[model samples]
Target: MTLFRQIYSLLFGLFLVVVMSLAYVQFTETQSFLSKQMESDLNNTSNSLGIMLVPDLEAGDIVGAETLINVIFEGGYYQQVKLTWLVDGKQQVWENDLKIDGVPQWFIDLGFFKTIKRESTITSGWIQLANLEITAHPGFGYHELWRSLTNAIIMISILFLIAIMLARFGLTWILKPLHDIAEHATDIAHRKFGPDMALPKTSELKSVVSAFNSMSHQLKQIFSSLDEEVSELRKKNLVDQVSALPNRQYMMGRLNSWLGEPNNGSLMMAKFDWLEDVHGKYGYQVRDETIRLLSEKMKEQLDEIAPSVIARIAAYEFAFLITSGEQEVCSKYLHTLIRTVNQEISKAGCKPNEQFYIGIAQRTDDMNVSQILAQTDNALQKAIADDKVFHWFESNEKQLYTREQWREHLSSAIKNKNFQFKWQPVYLTERDEIIQRELYCKLEIAGKEIHAGQFMPYVELLSLGSLLDRCLIETIADSGLLDRNHEPVAINLTFHSLSDKKFHEWLNHFLRNHRWAKRIVFDIPEAGVYSDPESCEALCHIIRDNGAHFGIDHFGRQFGSMAYLQTLRPSYVKLDQSFAFYDESEHSSELCRALVNVARGLDIQIIVTGIQEQPQLARFEPLKTNAYMGFIYPPEPVE
Candidate 1:
């Protein structure tokens, strides 16, 4: 039983005992008082009758004696009244059987009432005449005693009910502080060290509440220290000290990963020719401040645009990756960012906007990182040689359809539920066990299975993200995919769905109705979550509220604060694919380990993706990565 219920029962039991004891005492007292009152009336009647009959006995009026006796007996208070002559022992008697009204026979059988009888000698002129005896009817006394007990019982019953209600109300009031303390402890277990609770008025409970608040505050500080330490360690290893942008190692790893994927975004390499000259002329402080300002300017513009990956590869060079497939929008953001960076340079009194060269490269053909970087470098060198502001590497590609066509296609596909999806198992390396399956999806146009790289650009361009995400979840639920597999099926949510109220409501309903909803895990990109942390956190809460789980994808890609991970507290986090294949770099391996350690410390499962080679997979096992998924564990098509 709960403590509240146990205490409530014990208190009510004590109250019941007191009420019963008081009721018994009251009933017994009323009974005794009624018995004494009856005896007094009988004694007074016997004495008065003897004195009045004395005159009749002395005058030889036996008829008068009988008449007086009959008069008193007819009143019904006495059971029997007898008048006897003292000379001849002749007796005159008047009596009636005991009869009680408005009182039950069983009440009379309680046997507490007495048949009170009294007698007195009759005399005239100091001579005895006859004996006058009067017996009181127990019926009258029994009736009155029953009435007293009935009234007392009714009043006692009413008072007892009122006392019970008051006890329950007071108990609940006293235990409210205890309930709050229990809920606060649950939050602490989940790594959410919220605000302290208000202390209670009761001394014992007040001490408990104060202690819990102190413990809560201490836990918050400890978790905060851990989050900050791990975050700082990651930044020290991956971020440039002066620019606050990702360092060369981070940039190369991301570039390699993105190049292997299809139609993600364009990469822009920025060369600061005037920075070296400015550094030689100006002091170290000016050069460092200029770099910091330039990075800050770029970050401001990038935040306005969609999610992106940008880093500083060298003292005079930076790389920016735009993941959106919208070519027009990508071009706009790229040019705007260049303008903003050059403006910050001029504001810092360093260089004019046009003095810097930018080389843009997109995936026009299948090529290695070296070839792509060399081509981008060639474009940069050409721009510097030709004195041009920016240059784009040569490419021959065309958009197959316009906005309306792409929208119609996606809308129809979603409506028809024409989606091709597969589940890739995530292996716990030590046990060679599959904990869950991460979903890989593709759009089926007519009869072809087209990957996200082929159709996702258009989906983003046309703003069909929410519709597509909703349709995917609905189709999976309807197909009974969860029923077929015991392992949880993880689905990725889009940026649009994270902010959609209708989607949240529909997801809640779906989860409530579907029996297999508990096996569904929803995850969103790390950049998308960090871009809108509040909305993403709200979405995570909704998913969890409906018995589903949510996680973060590409976790380490965003070079931002780790505080959100503590508050958001996802079920699991997929480390960005770049972290998996460290390219034999110890610093890369160490950075990956730090990210994994932070996540594990917070009790969030960490899954490292893009583990293709055996060595790559083996390296993460020692770091205690929670799970691994890649070409090594291939996907199984879902029918």
Candidate 2:
């Protein structure tokens, strides 16, 4: 039993014992007093009667004595009365019995009062003439004792109830401090450390609460220090110590993450032409100094735009990943950056004619990181051949219409709700059972359908990403897919949508009214999660409160620390195709193991995506991935 109940029971038992003892003592006292009062009254009445009857007996009036005895007996106060005379050793006796009414035999038997009887000798002078006897009925005494006992019982019962109420109130009042302490402890476990504002009045409990508050404060400081250390370590591993910029590995991770999302960005590659000559003439020290100066100049020009990644990938080459939204603006910024670097180099004692060759490539929906980098490198080679300052990679063919045309098409599709959703099954690897179906959105255009990659860029560019998310949510809700399949349906949410406050409010209200909210899973890209962790954490709380699940897609591409997982606690993380393809390599395998260990520590599931070939799938067995997705388990078409 709980502490409160145990205390209540003990107090109640003690109250019962006390009341019973008091009632028994009261019963015995009343019985003894009534018995003594009856005996004393009988003795006094007998003595007085004997004196009055002696006159009659001394006058030799036996008849008068008998008359007096009958008169006293007729009063009906005594159970029995007797008068006797002695002459010549013979005795004559006069006796009568008195019965009282309204007293039950059982009550009298239970009361068990002894009858009071008294006798006195009467004579004219010295000799005894007759003996006078008197007896008193115990019915009245028994009735008084019984009444006193019943009253005592009723009074004690009331007191017992009052005492019970007092005990309950007292226990609850005293234990309120304990409840607050427990709640504080629970919040601390969730990493929300703070002192309880409440101060208890009880000395012992107050001391305990004060100690707990102190401990929480110390823990918070320790955790903050640990986070700082971890962040510094991560920086050391992913940053170029010489340039204080992201390293090549970090750049690749960022590029991979960007490619996984439905957005448009640009990449710039700059190569120094004089670095080799400088190294040959002044040794490696002068070359390193020039590189550092160039890195600083790059940061001064591009840092304002907040490029996603800037890295010195080679001794003489630096790459920039900018998400400036427009190709024209990106080109303008790059031209300006090139001019600034040329001036800075000329001022630093380099030849005026010698300049860095630059190559710029606009990211496309269909291009991978390697392909994009190749295009930039190809453009750089052309720049070198023509002796141009910079050259933009030109595409030979077009698979889609121009920007204006896409804008018009996507706008019309969203306005007309002309989109279809296709379900792609993700299965549990161990059981080979469908755990969820990932929903892919397709826009229908003039009897033709285009996938997300073909039109999402324009959708995001127009700031209609949230609108698309809403339409997809409503379509799934109306389709009854959840009701029919009895499994969760995963839908993608863009960074634009997650960061939009209005979208979050609308989603909360929408899910509140939707009956199948619990069966819905919102898949947010890992890039979106780390972009704004505070907002993402708030959104996660909202989603979970509404009975929906949230997870990270394209998880392994981000080379940063997994510390965010400790806060967001996403339900699952889907490994990007890069991890699955490179699973055989030792470096990739160790990274995957680290990710798995961290995720498992937080009870988060790991789902490997892009498991197309048997060899790739076999490599994941040792990692013990929780689920699988991709062409290996192609989705069955829904009628």
Candidate 3:
């Protein structure tokens, strides 16, 4: 039982006991008073009657004495009245019985009052004439006692109810702090380190809450420290200290893993041909400075073509992995990087002779790491022999359009509303219930459906990310699918859109006006959310206020603290597809488990993405993932 109930019951029992005790005492006192009053009344009546009877008896009028007794008995106050006389040494008696009414037998039997008889000797001139006897009925006393007992019971019952209510309220008020403490403990269990600032008035509970807050703060600091250490260790092992880029080992590992997938990207090798000349002319310091500057420029250029990885593999060679799309698209990005690097070197007052040799090789199903490196090396040798700055190994892929042509195609597609949405069902893993349909935006240009990978990179390059996101939202809302099914649909929004104040205002207005807005979920990338947490949090608040939900996609990839989760409090988190494919190493599994636990603690649901087979799905069962989405449950194509 709850504490309130226990206290109420105890209070109720005590009230009953008090009421009964008061009733017993009052009953006894009323019975005693009635008994004494009855006796006194009877005694006085008998004495007075005897004196009157004596006069009649002395005058030799026995009939007068009998008449007096009969009159008194007929008054109905006494149960019995008698007058006894002596004639020639024989006793003569006159008696009458009065009817008792308006009192129940049970009340009389309850012994509230007992019958009392009083007697007096009648005398005339110092001679005893007759003995007068009177018996009093307790019906009146019984009636009085019964009425008082009933009133006492009724009054006590009301007080009992009032007491019970008061006790219940008092207990609840006293125990409320305990409830807050329990909730704080629950939050801590979920890895939420927010402290409870409540200070209960009760000394014990206040102490307990204080201790709990201290423990949570300490745990937060410890986890933060451990995370920093782990991140530093990862960087030390895989990153090049000088350029702050992934080293050769890390690049090779990433490339080997990417090769196992079907949609691999192109790898470009940039070798500085004038490294020896720079060292000879400008000394080692200039040489190192040039390399650092080149690496920084490469990083800056790669930012435009994100989802790309660059690593300094050798002293003079840096490898670039462009996984955005096909070989043709990768070639365009490579050419952009080469031109940007040459411009930076020239702007830095470096000699025009200080050139870089670029070799590009497209990833193929038949090629391994060694083959890829050999092919790129062969291309580099050819470039060197021909004194060319850039060359592609076994170049055979055809480019559909120039950068300007691709840009125009995308702009026209958006303006003409030539994009279609495909719906992929994200299902609850345990019950196979479809919770939401994730919408993928596709562009149809000249009756050819352009894939996301082919278009998104260019979309980012042209600053059309917010436009695409807006189009997708408007398309989904206008289709009425959310209203028809009364189910939610998730639309992906890039960082640009999330940070766009105008987009946020527009979305807020749209949601407020649309009745089906609650069925729309904005799925933001984890990287985007972390990029500007304040903006993300603000947008999340707007979404929540409109009764819409927000989720994090590509989760568990960021190398930062998850404390932002406490503020954003997303409805769910979709695990990155890489988590499903990577070989389960101890470290990877532990990290995955930690992330899962953290999300679970925050009451956020985990949806594993890219489960292409039963084995992949089975791998996540032990983790108790809430949902799954991937090729295994391919999206239903919408025309």
Top of the candidates by lDDT: 1
After superposition, candidate 3 runs with Cα above 4 Å error: 45-177, 196-226, 246-349, 356-523, 532-551, 565-572, 578-629, 632-639
Candidate 1 lDDT at 260 equals 49
Sort every candidate by lDDT, greatest first: 1, 2, 3
Query: What lDDT tens digits, residue by residue, belong to model 3 across residues 530-584?
Result: 7788889889999999999999987865556777777788999998776776565
The sequence of per-residue lDDT tens digits that candidate 2 reaches over residues 1-639 is 877788789988888888788778878788888889888888878887888887777787777877877777666567777666765444554444333355556676664677678878877677878776677867668668767866786788788778878887898899888777888887677656655547799988888998878877886666565555445644555567767777776677667656754567788888887777778878888777777887787778776654446788877788888853567667767876777777766766677446578888888766888899999999888888888878999976454677788878877777777788777888897986888888887877777768776677777777888888888888767777778878899998877897989988999999888888999999988878877887788888889999999899988555566678767778999987656555255655666676676666556899988777778788889989899887776655554
lDDT of 2: 0.76
Worst 10 residues of 1 by lDDT: 256-265
* Model 3 residue 227 CA deviation in Å: 3.2
User: What lDDT does each candidate get?
Assistant: 0.79, 0.76, 0.75
Q: Quick one: best TM-score, which candidate? A: 1
Per-residue lDDT of model 1, residues 1-639, tens digit only: 988889988987897788788878877887788788889888888878877877788888888888888888888888888777889999877888766788888877887777788988877767887887788878777887788778877887888788779877887798889889889988877777788898888888888999999998997787676667657766777789999888877777787677645445677788987777778878788888888888887888885785576788988898887866566766787778878877876776766666789888775445667977887888788888888878888766765557787788788999999887988898887787888898877876666666766777677667778899889988887888888889999987877888877887888788888888789998788877777778888788877887888888888877677778877888899888888645666766666777776787678998888888788888887788778888887888876
- RMSD in Å for all candidates: 4.3, 6.7, 8.2
Q: For every model shown, what is its TM-score relative to the native structure?
A: 0.83, 0.73, 0.61
TM-score of 3: 0.61
Model 1, residue 168: distance off in Å is 4.7
Q: Alpha carbon lDDT of residue 490, candidate 3? A: 88
**Superposed model 2: Cα runs more than 4 Å off:** 15-238, 253-257, 275-307, 343-347, 351-353, 397-412, 556-561, 576-578, 581-585, 634-639
